[model samples]
Target: MMSTAHMASDSILAAATASMSIHSTSPNTTNSTESSISTPERPSGIDNCLIETASGRPVVPRRIVNPIAVAPMVDVTTSHFLHLCKIISPNYTLYTEMIHCNALVYHPDDLYNFFGEPWEGKVVQLGGSDPEAMAKAAKLVQDNGYKEVNVNVGCPSPRVQKGAFGAVLMKTPSSVVDIIQEMVKVGVIIPITVKCRIGVDNLDSYEYLYDFIKLVSTTTPVTHFVVHARKCWLKGLSPKQNRSVPPLKYEVVHLLAKDFPHLTITINGGFNTNEQIKEQLELVDGIMIGREVMDNPMFLAKVDAGYYNIPAEKIKSTEEVIEEFLEYVLTEHERGTPNSNAVVMAPLKMLYGGRRGKEYRRRLARAISPRTKSLPDIVRDVRLMMQEMDYGGVTTASEAEDNGGSESDSDSDLDAASHSASGCV
Candidate 1:
């Protein structure tokens, strides 16, 4: 009773599973008699290097070579937001929201929920303690064109703590190693990275963190670690409180880089401006920014030109980026994705942060308020408002009247349109 699409999907999964089974044992232990497995065909334009493993199988090389990455955030770094960030800074690495392994296993159809083009430079962060579950989730990410999979052992949210994953796993170094080993075993050819806090609760010692890193590195092939540069007080603090309340011990992360020079160590937490990022780069391999980027996304407009050495002519302006994103919004609207309003509006809300942005921000908020009707209507209102605000160019009141409205009349039309939209009632 399986549909054709379901059958095809099952075949792909079966092939992947068989491939893993053939290469399941330690590459270091394979004998001459074992047949070498071929590397998967990579996408065009990706610079891939194939190397023979100890098992003699051809393996594709994967590493976090980018020097800057946007941290994965819950509910905040959705596909829409990532698309916007990509527009502004094409070279900086991006991460998907922390996806629970259980959900991925149970709801396979949800994979198509990603709402953007150009999947390159993105890492999918998965949260789970179960080694098998994490392995399956890692495979799903790889199959979906993500070049890297990150194990999120840094989230201190109470919900994650209850799930026995996230920062809580830092206490069980052995379990963390097992998770990474299984992910590698299940054919995760790309870099399997870990994001962790400096320490958790009572285990806040440099030796403790070093031990955790050593065990995982020695036992598995995980070579990249993004240290959040803070300890998580699992019992007393909320997740938000955990972010700020813990004193940032950046020196601990710097020491990590010095001690584990072979590993790619990236520092996270308390980084906002280019100056801070430049300072951290002197010690660590990379930097990850979260809340600051979300609050003032315009900051990313400088990343390509400043950090990546991309030419100024290649970088698009804020207005040009917004215009391009609105086109994407229309496409998603036509597709009729659920909660499209919230998804499309999330990044749009972050658009007006420059000069004369206060009034523009207020108008944008009202345009996408719950009172707004359909996605199309919201788009129309947003476009009109942007034109009136002289986002890309100035539109005088005389021009507004020529287009069938005065300045105040346009505002009145927006209010009336919000009520007329289908969902507002």
Candidate 2:
């Protein structure tokens, strides 16, 4: 409901107009100048919380206040990444990178290490075909305290296809049912869900798609399906290209959801703007944001406050979040794990998105590259360079120097101790 006057102002004004549209309340509905979106009435029983698909499988939707979810990016959605996400916005249902079922159940220690605390209310994405392997993994996840277990049927990587998993699973609906059923039988009390593509390459027909849904539903009635609205070209496309090249067919997903009224569907793929997210929120039960969430990590920070009417801080500006992360990481470094790459690099990288982040990104990429210097030097020099750039507040070279010295001293001490012990032996 933006008038001509409001439309001409700025992007935030446009956003404000778009956000207010969610509730579609009267134009007069404004509280302190911020528009409020109305949430659906709370359901009576736990049944209301569960996402039951057309097939009748039930997955308890973890009561997500925000419709936003971070898409599971391989190598990126690790425990450390999920922890960082919680720091920025606890509203999101953080997803883990696809866990190989065989690896997870067999190497319990590795699986435990990967399932970090930020995952307490989050979902684990599993990749594998064997029902027993998947079921065993799901039981392990259930025991380890994951809120949800997701079967990944949309990844298009050659590495994954070689193993007859990921996007390839979409072609085998019966197998998916077996996996889901086995997980349920093994006492996976939490909802088990699926992230799948619209269809595979040439087989993107309504019948095939309907059959896929029906088979999974019959065996496991869990309704939380995150459908990336595209047909993955599994043959020649690289995983990255597969994500991009597949033209988004949101209608196909909408059609499926319409036919299967019982299921809760979240549409994904090519949705990058707030307007798009807001629009999709109106259509689907939820929205899984991928690159968009990465670029604008603060996007979901307002969901609880704005949409769900829960108390949440206004979305912090990129600079503000960066400042807080810098302080937190510095504190963590001081406590221990000073040299941990995951701890050090992640927050710094996250800051290089949204408005006015290009220069910082350029400088950081150059500083972190091996062509320039070692990691320790990169950390020291980059902090100094960022200071020179006058990012938010200036950080002094003296502070960077001190941090570098402490790290060097610790490394030296460890090296000396190792040498001494070896000589004594």
Candidate 3:
């Protein structure tokens, strides 16, 4: 459990969302029927726009008008990775990897050392049973410029279970309430929220969920609950399997929002298509998409242009985004403990998502191998390889362009598009 001192000291609020928005897509998309669809209006009796804390402190709603977020992947979604993703789609809200309360309150310097970045509008996901420890962790994040502190009661990993935190916390609402109270008491007042599963094992019942939400909401001003709309079978499934096998009862989550009008609820898990997000918006306050964003980063480009109704900018080629980020990474490396070349290459692989993606990843993996290739060597090798594949084995550039090839490739370009790291950034 968390100690009193930490919880009492960690409460806080936010400043503002840095000016960020998604870039645009091809022009033809805007003329399509799907493109003509309008974003639903914000809910009635719900100030669904950017909200304020109880103290009137500015709090941005978990709205992805950019409608795509970089999932809180653990190792794969660090601050550096988030910064990289921002270059591709700056409007996207980024999440911190799951921060264990033990690691957060005790080994904070070490925790921040690897994952920390001071982005003003970022969210911090925490794991712990002790209200005090969790509160302390929340405060640590608040002091560091994070916009929100979220309790991770949705991850079903055995390591997380063993620690009596993560998804397991869903089964203990009183504990969650205590943590929220401590965070509020300590002045870490930026919206404290929960990310959890519908239920655990065969114990899927509205009563369990109702009681859980009722207990916490009544006890503390926790207005946002990010529900991963799947049951987690504590006894039988691995975390990965748990994400899939359990049935998704989105209606149950919608009902939770209907039942508790004052609370803002967002649905997470298994959402891939924009149409799915559009349909979900009719029912919930926000939508959290995992893996999909990594697999197709440009997925939200259209959303920025359509749903949020902002005129989108041109989507930069992966090479362009990578080049800019590499400069940032190189500068950071020079100033501090440099990230391994492999660490840099991992996120870069997301750039190639379409038809030639497999070959692109293979080349990338090779370029960043411990036996390092020079920058010019990598650019020359990859460009030639992609160019060769584009030219039908003839190594012809004019022919590649004549084939209607897009310098900005699609999701079909990558061999494997799924992100392997846990949501950490």
Highest TM-score against the true fold, candidate: 1
In terms of lDDT, the poorest run of 10 residues in model 1 is 397-406
Model 1, runs deviating above 4 Å: 1-64, 114-118, 308-313, 369-372, 392-425
How big is the positional error of residue 171 in model 1, measured in Å on the Cα after superposition? 0.4
Q: Write the per-residue lDDT of candidate 2 for residues 150-186, one digit (tens) a residue.
A: 8998887777888888888876665677678778777
Q: CA lDDT of each candidate? A: 0.67, 0.60, 0.60
Candidate 2 backbone collisions, by pair: 53-223, 55-217, 56-221, 57-221, 57-222, 58-221, 58-222
lDDT of 1: 0.67
Q: After superposition, how far is residue 221 of candidate 3 from its true place, in Å?
A: 2.6
RMSD (Cα, Å) for all candidates, in order, is 15.5, 16.9, 12.1
* Alpha-carbon TM-score of each model against the true structure: 0.75, 0.68, 0.72
Q: Give me the runs in candidate 2 sitting further than 4 Å from their true place.
A: 1-64, 118-120, 299-313, 326-344, 353-356, 362-388, 393-425
Error of 2 at 5 (Å): 60
Clash pairs (backbone) in predicted model 1:
none
Candidate 2: residue 236 lDDT (0-100): 58
Residue 288, model 1, lDDT: 92
The superposed Cα distance between candidate 1 and the true structure at residue 58, in angstroms, equals 29
Give the candidate number with the greatest lDDT. 1
CA lDDT, candidate 1, residue 321: 72
